[model samples]
Target chain A: MAVEVQYYVLLSMALFSIGLFGILTRRNALLFLMSVELMLNAANINLIAFAFYHGNLTGQVFALFTMALAAAEVAIGLGILLVLYRNFRDVDVTVPTTMRW
Target chain B: MIYEQIAFALFAFITLASALGVVLLREPWHSALMLGVALLSIAVHFVMQAAEFVAMMQVLVYVGGGLILITFAVMLTEREDATDDTETNADEVVQT
Candidate 1:
């Protein structure tokens, strides 16, 4: 591979940080979910890059597994957001502070 | 080698920019579109590394399934911000 693995690492890092920024700054729950996905894909990029570098299929396998988990996560997350909307009539993550114990 | 370098630079830029768009865009709808762009570019990154299956799945799962869900949420959860503009437009139509 002419492209050094370093480039992938840097790209993934930038993507992950962008996700983190979204999570930290945005209050809307759906935006938070998207950011989390961004972070997850960043990790996947690393796995695949290392897999290619090492000449094994393990990284690709795990990347598939990660994709599965991400799918399930979004499903459950959207369900919860639906409920959050029904209960609070709003999707603001902060609004659930009313659930404080 | 030259082509690989150029492709990496191009897609890396695309991935980063659209990712930033997902974070920085004010409207959830627009953010969803940006997320789609970001995911598709990430898939390209996968292809560059010879993970063709992963790239296809990225397009199928992330863009097809995940993005649709996100757009549904954005549409369903659209609350305060869009209401006024819609209301004003409705009133204008009635007056006309």
Candidate 2:
């Protein structure tokens, strides 16, 4: 009746892969940010799942820190995204070619 | 016991599907909504795993704050005419 930890691990892996694929294929900067968040969520899921499996609170505590970090990341990332849109007039990831060598 | 398995399957399916929708949707607003759904489902999963505090935090931070931030970004960055033109172009590519 109890859910196996493997199932949770597999679920997180699938989510992480989807996020990675989006990062690689999506041209929209906002989509990239969303993908990154998805990846982070996957990591958090793993942390908590392992914590539960091991009967310890370390993983959950780490997950809490991860959430705080995610919050800060969203704040900084959105600010950068807003600036990028203003400067380039588009949120397309391919627009910023100036840095390309 | 059986019910727990069923709930787990349901939550996992919803979470994965909406996560896919988040990345694959053309409209940013739609993607944002899907992301919200995915996060909510993950919160449900957290509850299933007995991490009640994490589940609440997931709802508060992700569903509440993160979603609003994404929605605002989508609104602020939207240029209606430009988006329409781009949408048509994307449709053409998809058709081909």
For each candidate, give the interface RMSD after superposing the true interface residues on Cα: 6.3, 3.6
lDDT of 2 by residue, A16-97 (tens): 9999988987877788888988999999999999999999999999998998899888888899889988997777766677
Compared with the true structure, model 2 gives a TM-score of 0.92
Pairs that collide, model 2: none
Q: What are the DockQ scores of the candidates, in order?
A: 0.44, 0.47
List the global CA lDDT of all models.
0.90, 0.87
How do all models score by TM-score? Answer: 0.91, 0.92
Q: Among these predicted structures, which one has the highest lDDT?
A: 1
List clashing residue pairs in candidate 1.
none
Task: Give the Å shift of residue A1 in candidate 1.
Answer: 4.8
